[model samples]
Target: MTAATQPRSVNSAAADDVAPIVQRLRETYARWTRRTPIEQMRDDWDELFRSRAQPWRINGFEAGGVAAEWIMAPDARANRTILYLHGGGFRMGSIDSHRDLMQRLSIAAGARVLGINYRLGPEHVFPAAVEDALSGYRWLLDSGVRSGSIAFAGDSAGGGLVLACMFAARAANLELPSAACLMSPWTDLAATGATFLSRADVDPLHQRPMILSMAKAYLGPSGNPLDPLASPLYGDLERLPPLLIQCGDCETILDDSVRLADRAAKAGVAAELEVYPSMIHVFQAYGELHAARQALASAGRFLGRYFTEQDKRPPEGRGDTRDCG
Candidate 1:
């Protein structure tokens, strides 16, 4: 709900270390009570990125028929790429809003980051954003970026979008990326998880009405939430690449990642889920927070190893997972 609501207890001293920062984030989000128009929201999101000095270089790319940017840290490898999709409920986020986040992730994972500004909703609607993301993936492959060297990543809605792209890619007979790392993935568009109610008191960003509104706008009036393209949670998960999903323990969408992991594993996919204690949605976006740093580092290691092994080896550790609270 808000930072004023105390979080459910956790078992470790690390939670104690991260609790204050997490609470502060919640308080900040709680203060975001007023709703702005979509354009204002986009501007405001970019302002957060503009307020700070950039730690990496950013350049414009061909966009592959969709707006996109290329981000690289000093140590980023050209051959390795992370196809990044920004999360804004499929209606608002841009590459500018997620530039720094991509930079940090690129450095951590030792890969070049390609961030795309896919079509947003209430205008473009469902399948449009998904189509743009698929375009980005297709461009990467056509440009000679090895499918094994590519990994997909996104936060919140973007997280689910990347997964949806995987399903689309497979149906089109395109080689899937080596792996994916979803930050607080919004896998369930229907908002079916029990945590929507249980964690509502502690989660600062999401609530049912707002969630459903975003869903409706992205889906348009006629789109079905259960359509595999709209919500990968309902899709057949077999033969999809490995996945690493990270979500805050206090999120309303906590079970989105939880349920996705459970189903992915059952359907023969490698899905690892990490629930960060006391943190709110997309904690990795707050690079100043310790939990965010730890989470990104973990995701970096996860993707780095996979990037190296994707072309050279078999998926031997496909079902292994390391869970944390």
Candidate 2:
């Protein structure tokens, strides 16, 4: 699990609303050294969102063969869609675990968000999640959703799946979506990013061994760690849709986003990278976090125009990459 180290500057101040949440998570995390039952985790995940009340129009339906739900903010556009993939290392997470985030993104992007309950690993392994995600995309296309009107967005492992879904879609000869936004994406399941060491003392949530164990569970015993679909950081990035990658300097997988943006640039893709100072994995999940709201707003502005073909896109590989915190 080694790779070339890249220089990343740090910013000391984390948003005031974020520190307490991170501290709580860190304390709670210290108690669980091993995986918890998926059912219990699922309940806990949903419970975190229960305290936040929002009037969202949620509808349940099947996307391809997978069970899913459409989360729409009151004024969300019906024509445009954001296919959201939830993240729990591909082993946990479902529509329930992610409704709050999905609802927020739907409003931010002003598009309906279709979130799927993709099969989890250790029970459903690699390609199963990928396949379910693709099925949701297929359902969108079949239902006459224009490719340009749809955007792909996800966080952590789900963020990686956003890229994997596009790759899978390209292979199936389907049209690519307008753009994508990844939040603290776990692009390298191979756990090779130098940040696994560099950010070790900073990121409170993840470590190399933990990531490797999650990867092994998702990939099964024989799956290749470098399989392009499983680890999009190792995949070919040529001719994919425009990308907006948001990462935090304090996260162990920060390098995954940095290197991903580099690969996207080298492959002639339009990529924007924003590194927030002193943030952690999926910090966007915390509604109270100001940086979280800012990141989602940035993603909204990036993907908003695409929903209506009003793309006043900045040129590829522009100077938008920076410490935006």
Candidate 3:
């Protein structure tokens, strides 16, 4: 078969092995959606995720009035760090909700991780989360973390926020992060991607209605759905930092990752897109899945490469070299 028409396969065996786990996840999500009210969903999610114990040493702090947490990793690079935003449609997720994932990310990237508890929807609404994200990143810079040495990362809605953050930072003339990694980013708030319907049956956690509802909640009634800060797919991606995107073929948001990668690459930015077969949204957070581990490791290698390159580059002309001392 020709390259374009060839049957693609990556980790098919592993996908088959994880089918049962994915099924359970699907069933659980179905139950959650059916029984939970929209207003209670955030606290419900917080309680559910908080109940799961994490094995990492985490500490709490504040950045620009935003609550944040740090997942400490041993043997971590002193200067390199990750600013992580959690995914929950910009409404539900919190620092505790993603600590396990943060711990794994810290260990994999060999860098400390700062998980930002950005304001959520149906409460703070549009621009609040994005503002909080920028504030956290600025706090990192102010606290001695060079932009060139830090990487920005997030999953789902958080992933989209990471891209939005990049755009805002670039516009402000601040030095961009060395790299960014996104997992199943919700880049299009318009819900216009073909996969939203084509892959609806396969996606375990999302449906178009729920996606639209979350987007509306986060964007507010008057907010523009295509606002670049709200939906990064509409933004100019030129000159942004190198990007790494991971998505599962089965996800409704798969096209978001694909399209973002295409846009970034077309705009002359270095980008890498990895699609996992038969996987669901943000599969990297599921510790039971092999693809999750593989994706994290790949992200780690990607981060390490950029970090090393940033270290070797000449300090002159790079605006990130301001002495923190």
Q: What's the distance in Å from true for residue 78, model 3? A: 1.4
Q: After superposition, how far is residue 319 of candidate 3 from its true place, in Å?
A: 21
**lDDT (C-alpha) at residue 84 in model 1:** 98
Per-prediction tally of clashes: 3, 0, 0
Off by over 4 Å in 1: 1-36, 53-55, 309-325
Write one digit per residue (lDDT tens) for candidate 2, span 28-111.
Answer: 555553567766665665666655637654577787888988777767766668899999888777787788888888878877
For candidate 3, give the lDDT of residue 147.
85
- TM-scores of the models, in the given order? 0.86, 0.88, 0.88
Q: Cα RMSD (Å) between model 1 and the true structure?
A: 7.9
lDDT of 3 at 52: 54
Q: How accurate locally is residue 272 in candidate 3, as Cα lDDT from 0 to 100?
A: 84
Q: What is the lDDT of candidate 2?
A: 0.81
Q: Which lDDT values do the candidates have, in the order given?
A: 0.81, 0.81, 0.81
Q: Write the number of the candidate with greater lDDT, choosing between 1 and 3.
A: 3
* TM-score of model number 1: 0.86
- Summing lDDT over every window of 10 consecutive residues in candidate 2, give the lowest-scoring window: 316-325
The 10-residue segment with the lowest total lDDT in model 1 = 316-325
Cα shift from native, residue 263, model 1 (Å): 0.4
